[model samples]
Target: MKAEEMWKASTGKGVKVAVVDTGVNPDTPSLKGQVLTDEVPKEVSYKATEDYDGHGTSMAELIAGTGADGTLRGLAPDAKIVPYRVALTGLDKAEMQKAPHLAKVIRAIADSDVKIINMSFGGKIDLPDVREAMKYAHDKGKLMFAGTGNDAMETEFTGFPAAYPYVVGVAASDESGVVGEFSQHGNYVDLAAPGLDVPTWCDKTFRSYCTGEGTSMASAIASASAALVWSAHPDWTANQVLASLIDTAGRDWARDDPSTYLGYGLIRPRKVLENKDFNPGPADTDPLAKENFRGVVDESGKPVAASPSPSTEPSKGTETSDGDDQGDRASATASETDTSGNTTLWVALGAAAAALVIGGGAFAVIRSRRGA
Candidate 1:
């Protein structure tokens, strides 16, 4: 489905998406007017308009960009992007050696007013504090999605954030709908999308665009699709929105035979949106209530940590509250620092302006970009 059609109903105007990553740049043309920072908390040192690393900017563009300069286009063009600059890359070896600040940033996003949270970063270890924070967001009625990691050629290991219960784990697929060989496969994968030949920012400078091949872009797309639905039905609870997506996901296989690599299949929000009378299932039913489901009840009926594999680092600092801050992961942030190799684009962005509005209506569109 084209994004232009969805804009007719709603452009995600009232919906806010919180991106938690290195940072975002507010100058991008595609992201000019789509970002909102007023709701972000002040405690966080990051700005919602700056993007230090190009990774977050690219992800942002994929979710809500305006398609300026003939660059990447987003699914929810009118949605607002809230940036959060978490320390994922190392300032030095010591900074790199420290545990990622994902936990802090995620907790902050949940605490804020944003309804959608996108996290495109992952590592082998599962930070305990981060898991708790994710659960907190789920309880708060926030929709969260994360990358399933890209370590297939290496150790073929599993990673956290994606593996956490309540967090929608996304996988990478090629233009032909085939799962990429590099995309890690596991029971945690919840969905798949075009990630092999996606376009994005190459650096914080916003100089040029590049072709990206990973699950990060897929996660961003999934999150944006959610934004489209949430924006249309502002009264729907987070549980209802998520349940609708799960119920309408496209798959040729049996409902019980969820692919370890592809999860429920590619998301088709159109299926959910087309049927105005469609039911979103039970609001209390966890969309992931089957095997590999999260928020599981113990034999004693108490909520237990469902993490089969936990992060190596010890939990530190009490995250007393659940609120969102100005840290957008897949999109632009207020300016900051990034040392990762250039692989994204930076541009001058306006505030919430969208040129095209795709819809849940199926159309023969969705221009694929290759080798930017």
Candidate 2:
């Protein structure tokens, strides 16, 4: 994605992204004047800016960090963040109990003016209340994104919130467009983004950025990508925004036979932004209608409906590569050059070293215990 060129069109200005994660530190050098603390509802705003682990702040910075004082530059630096904190692994037991419920936080965000909800976290359990909350947010027309998960080695369980219908589940990929082996794969993955070797806050201290990999980072990037598209086409509804992404995503395989590892393909918001006259289909028609309707279990643990799948013409004029054979591993290491001329770690290593070699353990515990 030629981010600089896309910036010539839109910097995600005037868009608000609701980050439903651990919390966001408003005082961070890059986040100053970016996080909307007061906009968070009073009832579920407890410790909204107190990030126990550095993960929440990292995700926040990935989406909207202003890149001040050598900090990470966000993909949507001009967007605003409405932070929310919920219980996760490593939090003190008492504190975790005191945090607002996840469903309530989701509901609050649904009722707010936030255009996007970025949940860079996941869990194996699919709680009905959480799914209902997600549905409520969807009904309210919010564009939601979540990590498919980082524990592809330990479990094949489809991560929830990500598996929930109407939510865009994102998987991790390298700069070369190779899906990370650590990225859990399933029919639920809707898109892919760069996740390997990304710089992240090492801990709660926020002292330095450490190399990390997981679907968490991928989800953040996807959300920011949507922000850029939404900012460029302010009149487009959530469906249209998502449809635009699906229309222009980089993929090698037929769109109807989406890869289980990379989803539709690596998200390339630049393609959508570059085309001023791009048609995004209908505002009410879901791009993933077939996948959402087929074989998906609802919060009530029941099948909704089996609808005839819609047809998609193969995308032309974009780069293409062979789809990964399920469970095949490969290797490469690369750095991403930011607008400031800084070389940050972009995931290194091919498929073989994708899971065990990358040190993404930090995200595993947090996501696994999201609602435990």
Candidate 3:
């Protein structure tokens, strides 16, 4: 992506992304003035600013970090962060009990003005309450993104919250647009983003940055990508913002037949930001309506009738590529000139990777990283 030129159009200003994770540290060098602690509801605000494991802070920084003190700079550098703390792994038993429930946290954020919800965590189990909350948020017009888990090579299990309808399941990818081996796959995967070799906070100490790799980083970047498009087109509904992303995403497969590993392909926000006259189609239309309505079941393993009639058309002002072979593991290229008179070539690689399994049940930060 032509990030520098893209910033010339929108820096994700006036947009707020809610990070539902362990916690977020507002005092970080890159996030000093970027976090909106007061925006989080008081009832679900326990330790919201106190990051116990540093995972939440890293995600928040990835979405809105200012790059202060040579720290990691977020894609939407001018976007604001609304932090929410929930009980994920690494928290003690007592702390877990005290932390607000994921369902409640999601409900609170849904009611608020936060445009995007970034969940950089996941687990194998799906809770009924959380699924209901996710539906409520979707109805409220909030664009939600979650990691597709890091256990693709271990098990065929799809992570909850990500598997839940209305949540865009993001998979991890490198700068070359190749999905990471650890990034989970399945019908739930919606998109891919740069997740490998990215810098993130090491721990709660906030002492240094570490090179991290996981779907967690990819989720945060996906949320930030939405922030950029939403900020540029403030009038666009959540559907429209998402539609634009789906329309412009880099892929060699048809929009309807998304790749199991990379979804509609890697996110290319610059494709939207660079073009001022981009059309996002109807506001009431959902780009992922077909996928969202399908594969979602209720408590009794019965399919839920979420929408009246899902549309077959993916989006407007977009065309399907002729690369029909989904199993073709070959790299493709697309090049263009930026507003700054610089040439940029995006390498869209085929998907292939390994996996690892984290503990099941309660939500755990989908962390896969190496210390710097």
Q: Pick the candidate with the highest TM-score.
A: 2
Give the alpha carbon lDDT tens digit for every residue of 1-372 in model 2: 666667789889999999887789999887999999999999999999999877788888888877777677778889999999887655677887788988899999999999999887766665778888988998898999988765564445666667888889887766666666567767777887777667667778988766666777788888888999999999999999998888777776666667666677778788898889999889898787766777666799986732222112221111222221111111001111000000112221232321111111111111110110
Cα deviation of 184, candidate 2, in Å: 0.4
Question: How many backbone clashes are present in model 2?
Answer: 12
**Per-residue lDDT of candidate 3, residues 1-372 (tens digit):** 666677789989999999888789999877999999999899999999998878888888778887776666677889999998877766777887898988899999999999999887776666788889998998999999988766554445657677788898887665556666656666677787766656566677888665556778778878988999999999999999999988887776666667667778778888898889999999998788777766667999976834212112221111111211101010001011000000011111112211111111111112221111
Compute the lDDT of residue 328 as modeled in candidate 2: 12
Each candidate: RMSD to true structure? 9.8, 10.8, 13.1
Q: How do all models score by TM-score?
A: 0.79, 0.81, 0.80
Task: Report the C-alpha lDDT of model 1 over 1-372, residue by residue, as the tens digit.
Answer: 544555566566678888776666766877787766666666663544555557777777778887776656677777889987665642334533332356667777887889999888776566678778888898888998887765554445555678887888877655445565556666677776655545566566778765556777778877888898988788888878888877676665666566666777766676666677778877777777553434677888876656533222221111111211111232111112111111111222333333433222221121111110
Q: Whole-model lDDT, candidate 3?
A: 0.70
RMSD of 3: 13.1
RMSD of 2: 10.8
Report the error of model 1 at residue 279, Å: 1.1
Q: Decide which is better by TM-score, 1 or 2.
A: 2
Off by over 4 Å in 1: 47-49, 90-100, 291-299, 303-305, 308-372
